[model samples]
Target chain A: MNAPPITTASAESPALPNRFDLTAAIKDGLKTALIMLGLSIPILAYKTDQSGGDLWLSPRWGLVAILCALVFGLRILLHAFMATKAAREATPSPHQATEFVHAEPNAFQKTSRFAIPFFLGVALAFPVIIYFIQGGLNESRYWVDLGILILTYVMLGWGLNIVVGLAGLLDLGYVAFYAVGAYSYALLSTTFGLSFWICLPLAGILAGFWGMILGFPVLRLRGDYLAIVTLAFGEIIRLVLINWTDLTNGGAGISSIPRATFFGLPFTSGEGGFAQTFGLEFNGMHRIIFLYYLILALALLTNFVTMRLRKLPVGRAWEALREDEIACRSLGINTTNVKLTAFAIGAMFGGFAGSFFAVRQGFVSPESFNFLESAIILAIVVLGGMGSQIGVAIAAIVLVGGPEILRNLTFLQAVFGSGFDPNEYRLLLFGAGMVAMMVWRPRGLISERSPTVILKERKAISGSLVKEGHG
Target chain B: MRWIQDPLLDVQHLTMRFGGLVAINDLSFKVGRGDITALIGPNGAGKTTVFNCITGFYKPTEGLIAMRKPDGSNLLLERLPGNSINWKAKVARTFQNIRLFSGMTLLENLLVAQHNPLMLSSGYTFLGILGLGGYRTAEKEAIEKAKFWLEKTRLIDRADDPAGDLPYGDQRRLEIARAMCTDPLLLCLDEPAAGLNPRESLELNNLLLSIRKDHGTSLLLIEHDMSVVMEISDHVVVLDYGTKIADGTPSEVKSDPRVIAAYLGVDDEEVEQVEAEIGV
Candidate 1:
């Protein structure tokens, strides 16, 4: 019925046994080896001591040669194998070539329903399980700290999900509100001598107010333009913090910020301390445990509020705005208010997380709020699937907690030699994972969404049915 | 056709210019209350422009658009912001191309149309978030209203389906249903029957006629389908080259020489006949 097929692969080019040419392999290896040497010169060739007192030149010529040899060997082997395989399968079978592109998922999808709840159970039991496994709170502090860090991102991801995921507004300066919250709490606590609890809500409100301020002019902008403006807003806030020395203390930041107390009772070793009030001996572990639960409760609150908001009128308005801004306007939804509300609510959560971050660390710095932090939070949202709350949590654990997990893998040194630090390669893996995820599941790890409003039983809508928005 | 003595919507010397190009030039017309007014012309003849201006999608370069409501209040539509027209002036519109909140469910699409009311009831989401009884009652009423429209549009079965997943005909119906949920005094439909098959067009005509008959909604539509326009429209306004050529009942406008000449692409002699028929 159609045009005749062109020459098949076997008829076009027959594979020969002499595919392994040593000379070509050596040429490719030499070129790659030279490029690696040129690239690694600055980073690997010279090293300065932490104190800037000593300098040394260390050459890894042997390792470079070994890596080059491995690359060359792998390339040649792959070429030969691929060539032979191609010749064998030259005559394409109709059945083999014509499977539907969007067929049902094979193995992984079948297990996802079980996997989600299993992971949730694990997350809920994480701290207690670790406490028992490590035999006491002392040994579990590191894991608890890591848990706190991951939950913070999960909260941030869920918060930003409301704006970027549901509302379809790409906000790159999310960290600015985070900074606002952190500073608000820091300044409130230090100057006015307020407690963390009082400063927390105040910080969130201040951050949300700032969110509306920034949201006003940029609400008219869509897609990449919105992203660029938000990114600039984030950088502007950072720059302001750096230049304004009196209020922010410039680069020095506000240090020695007061820690959060258990209600009015402090966690210190004094008479009115939490442990002292309870008639228990003051163990520093109490503070660590308290902070973990505090952040956990905050994160859960973020999740709960987000989930509830999804069913509200404003939440539906956000999703509608994301789908079609023109349609939204035609429906009499004030696009300005919808977009501003998204920014404010998302910023509110970020503010909450930031204040917690301040109380947790007992310090605030300009360094904490940066572009990289925003990117990482955005990465978590994107990798999680924009609108899925559970997806964001899992992505946080995998992306944020994954790198920390790598830090503990000391056995990696035996494989790549002692100089190899896994922490340095965390970003490399992050980039690779993001690229891989785009190719594999462009919608995200959890793409299917349960519609917030439904009739009868709720059905999970496929990601293909949803708009990813301008972002 | 019998009509109200006073025009519900009055457009005076409406002119829309986009830089050097004039889209609508000194256009003037009147749409009577509770009347189905069809705006028809050849493509690029500014049929949709009039609808856009009346619906506040575009502010005419020079015009006074006044809408006399049932309460005897007059609204200057052009003075209002685009989004506010739906709420303040009670004017809702459907796009030439279907623009349902495609990502949302059919019911959700209708609910979004009632956003202003629901938003107010929820105290701008503050009360809604707190799960107050007042917000719940408002939400329930909104859902009931959405269900009523869904039933009217014959899309009650597919109410839970994502609007984008609906068939083309249902999407058209859903767009109308969604607009109806907004409870507009005047519904501006931009080619609601554009892509529909014969049966769907018939359904659309019935739906629109029912809207006017049962709900007392005054419709100002931009239509390309002559059959639908002739069969249903109480009044027809014809435009050519951004200017109104004929304005009267369907038969009067249909037989007008200017509309025939514009559609047939006639020469100078026909143009004179058009000018004579228009008495300009």
Candidate 2:
């Protein structure tokens, strides 16, 4: 398909065309469809055979798919030729507009003045909208599972955003807190036969305690040294989980673990099961839906608390510390207390999410909380935009939820033949998307909001007029 | 001799060392209430070092920097950490290389200087995040204070502009405005006129004079420009090799043979020329 016109000049440039047609969009769409169809047929045929179905549909449809693919491919080549010819025929124009970049926003252009209300409205209405639409209420177990997954990552993203985003502290081993929370809940609940509710706070407290423990050694360290220490701390937590067999279940994992009950009612078909006791029909989806709402609530609470903390003096202190440590110190702000509070609070949230994870899975394993988990969570925070609550939620949805949505594309299997699985290429696509996002928006989806101070006359100022450092 | 009131800041035997080199050695000076004292020296005379030591940037090996507050409470600045020095002593300062929060607007930079006051108004409550009631009031007050300084510094028109984007002269004035927003009792300035043109320097002189006239805030300055020193300073102290060589009024220090020797790089020949130049 033909590429879009570069349109390199600014909006005011006289060289710009009056209107550029998006006619190539249709051809591009057709090309993509044909390519996918050409690749999916054999794979669908193989799957059909494995499921004991007709064999002829695969080969017959494959030929037709290839033929259409060839036609689209030739069209793409022709379009490219036409685009180059058109470009060469056009005369060069030179009326470029001057672009002005501002370092800071004006009082009138303050981001917080608008963003706080916008995000709060979204957070408040999201559950109501989901309920009205009956989202996850009648869906298969996987839909509810997907909801839980999104919530889990959302909480983790918020937690990690505090450490890495708000504080400008790169934590490569944040999963250590997750592990500490999960294992604490698992060990305590199982050993004492306690319920999930009671153990949850205990687990979070334990994780927060460990965060302080970790914070002490890295107090004087910054940047790379702090990252390495946190990474080692995570490894230490994982190693202990693996080596300490008596306390934990070792590599075997705590299987046949008790699933979290709904207000003490199990989902089983027993006398005390939720379905039987409530006179409702038994469906595994009920349990999944319950877990989904449970996690969604927790995630919302995490976001709410984080948002509140950020507006406080401590929150501003954290931001100031992030911007310039020397300045923060000169202002009489205690850097040590600020750093410790951030670590503890961030870890506490992680622990809450981890405890919820253990209850949701009904099993705890060291393998689940690995370096990759830490990396993925960190990526979510970075990609979402640091120091932004809503950005983390949006990023989690795209990064974690995107792969699951891709799994439902059965049409891709038909085009790729028997050997190709779309899941295998999900990470490759994810990596490419990340690269594209970085190039397109280096400051992440939402840039830092400028602080508003009341001017004598309260005159509005445009953000572009201000000059502030981006980083 | 008019003793005036007690010195707002008293520095005794202030010594700072960087390994083998002594940046400030046994330096003693007293800045009287509402006095604009100039610490003048040749380059590398450790004028800025003394400022740093007094501001708690560098801990002196042996010294007592007692800042007498309006309430007559003494704050031993040397014993406090760098962060606590600002709050306890109410001593504000400006850097030779202006360190305004570049990404913040001119008004926001000023308000940030009042961070402690705003925190107190909020009672450090989480409800402050919602910006309800009291927090809103405090925020409004902060803005008013910021605007007051902006007007004072003649930056009201560009209050919403980012501080870093301002013209060089405006940035220097904004730095002073930011420091003033802290409501400090004493202001320490390090080479505020280093890069300013003649007109800008005159404006700065006017601003500093107005500050002393209106706020009654004592000024401690380290400057190389003899014009600035002789123009505004009530008293001048000359240093050579981290030791004080002369301390008196600008005219008295200007006439001191020792001060002349330190500036002219001569023991005898240049001294006569220095006296002639000062009309002494």
Each model's Cα RMSD: 5.5, 9.1
Q: Report the C-alpha displacement of residue A297, candidate 1, in angstroms.
A: 0.9
Which predicted model would earn the best DockQ? Answer: 1
Best-performing candidate as measured by lDDT: 1
lDDT of 2 by residue, A349-399 (tens): 899888888888889899998899999998898888776677787789899
Q: Which TM-score value belongs to model 1?
A: 0.87
Give one digit per residue, the lDDT tens place, for model 1 in B1-280. 4444768898899999999999999988888899999999999999888888887778889989998888999999999998889998889999988897776788889988988998889887777788874888888899999999999999888787788778788999999998998999899999999889999999899999999999989999999999899999989989888988888899898787778888888888777876886677
Cα lDDT computed for each candidate against the true fold = 0.86, 0.77
* Model 2 / residue A269 / CA error / Å: 4.4
DockQ of the two-chain complex in candidate 2: 0.26
After superposition, candidate 2 runs with Cα above 4 Å error: A1-139, A255-258, A264-273, A276-279, A413-418, A448-471, B1-5, B124-136, B157-161, B267-280
What TM-score would candidate 2 get against the native? 0.78
Candidate 1, which segments miss by more than 4 Å at Cα?
A1-121, A417-419, B1-4, B272-280
lDDT of 1 by residue, A53-147 (tens): 76655566666666666766766676667656666676466767476222233343466679877876776788899999999878998998998
Q: How well does each candidate reproduce the native contacts, as fnat?
A: 0.66, 0.37
